[model samples]
Target: MKTRSKIEEEYWEALERLKSGTTKSVDTKSTRFKFTKDAVGREAGRGKGYVRYERYPLLCEAIADAEEARKKNGPATPTANAKLEQQKALKQKAIGDYNQLKQEYDLLMTEYLNVVRRNFELETGLAETKDVKIIRIPNVR
Candidate 1:
């Protein structure tokens, strides 16, 4: 088992390596940190020849912190900007299509209402006129 102080020191070292881009991944075989079992027993003053399972969680936490810091400090690249512009254009096109469909729907609805009104007048025997006039109907049984 590694001492608490030694584990903390290794954590910091791993974090520094992550920030410096010396290692691309943490808590994996690809990790270049000397705290792993792979680094143990290889060379003197390198590291203990065993995996420190207890320190794994701390190492993972440090890696996550470094990644977050990098994200905040990183600038938006050109590719990211281009993707954003593309998304905006697609949204505009969809809005335009929806508006066109709405206009067509409104026109069709108006025409349908006019047809229904004309049919109702014909069935009721009502004539459109400026003045009212009485019409006599023949009684048929």
Candidate 2:
């Protein structure tokens, strides 16, 4: 049986080789094991034909850890930058749309208030004054 540390080390080496394009896709646990075995060579308890099904979970964990590390430490590729720019543009468009809607709301609200005040004056038999301010008190239920 191989030690955990040894297995992890081999996994990392294989991952690095894959990243560097020295190896192809390690898309499956079996392929990952094969890559690790090929890089670190076969051990006594884990011979060439060994299925190593018990180590599948550990290999998956290693792959996840490696992916996270790559995201944190790897260079900002053009694809990543393009995605960021796309998100920024979407956010800016949303902000602009919100501002436009807010302006339209304000305009509509002013027109509605004007109409309500005119109707109030007509109903109350009050003179049409330009400076009359309406104080709306909320009814607490």
Candidate with the greatest TM-score versus the true structure: 2
Q: Write the per-residue lDDT of candidate 2 for residues 54-127, one digit (tens) a residue.
A: 65556655546656765676665468889899899999999999999999999999999999999987756534
All predictions: root-mean-square deviation over Cα? 16.5, 13.7
List pairs with backbone clashes in candidate 1. Answer: 40-48, 40-49
lDDT of 1 by residue, 79-99 (tens): 888989989999999999999
Could you estimate the TM-score for every candidate?
0.34, 0.35
Clashes of each: 2, 0
Error of 1 at 27 (Å): 37
102, model 1: CA deviation in Å?
0.3
